[model samples]
Target: MISATTILTFIGMATATYCSRILGYLLLANRVLSPRARAVMDVAPGCVLISVIAPHFVSSRPEEIAALAITLLAASRLSMFPTVVIAMTSLGVLKSVFN
Candidate 1:
């Protein structure tokens, strides 16, 4: 059960986080970015994802690693709705078996 205080705290955090993103976009959207800047922006997400996720994956516990493996296996074997269902099933089984 969520208390009123917890609800307000969640709302406040969400609003602040959203405003920070909106503010950044508002500042950048008005100016035309250079070709180099645009290219960097395009590549940034993959770089950021690699940097962020690679550390977590490399540093993962055995169970988390197992779950990741299952997710990847599911990814390879399924498509569309089946892919989503298979991934979620993998997640459930992995969590139960490993954790």
Candidate 2:
């Protein structure tokens, strides 16, 4: 069901993404990141994570908010796999009970 335009757009986007990454790697392959640059890179994931999650948290229901809090707490105490499982399970249970 994909139109030619849609297919071309997808290909264009994919090419752009790969080109950007390749360009970064090629340009920075031999360069050492400054301390500031390294620090920025280290915090980038957390900044992006907050940017992504903050909006959803703002709009979500109380049950979802509770689930998010529980997930955060679980994340602090547990590793990735257990945290993910707990978050998904809690969300599923909350959704089932509330909605």
Candidate 3:
């Protein structure tokens, strides 16, 4: 069974998430971003992705680190689908061999 504090925390988090999303929609509705703002927004997704993935990478084994490096290099030279495939394949092979 869950404690009362844990339940309340979950409810609080859900409410905060909903409120922030709704507020953002209301504020941005029918509005155009400046070119500078748009450029920042364009970079935001990749930056956010890196921020989220960085922690996992930091805790990864050497093989995982090598896989990430290979993936990044592939990403620079290839498209998204191919990069993802290469990354997955490399990670699988490395994990199998190293583990």
Q: Best TM-score goes to which candidate?
A: 3
**Candidate 3 ranges with C-alpha deviation above 4 Å:** 1-31, 56-60, 79-81
lDDT of each residue in 1-99, candidate 3, tens digit only: 335674565355445544545665677777898899757644543453354336547855977788888878897998544755576667667877887
Worst 10 residues of 3 by lDDT: 44-53
Candidate 1 vs candidate 3: the TM-score winner is 3
The C-alpha stretches of model 1 lying farther than 4 A from their native spots are 1-24, 45-48, 67-93
State model 2's lDDT: 0.62
How many steric clashes between backbone atoms does each model show?
Answer: 0, 0, 0
Q: Write the per-residue lDDT of candidate 1 for residues 1-99, one digit (tens) a residue.
A: 335674565355445544645665777888899999767654543343233234437745765576567656664676433533454455456656765
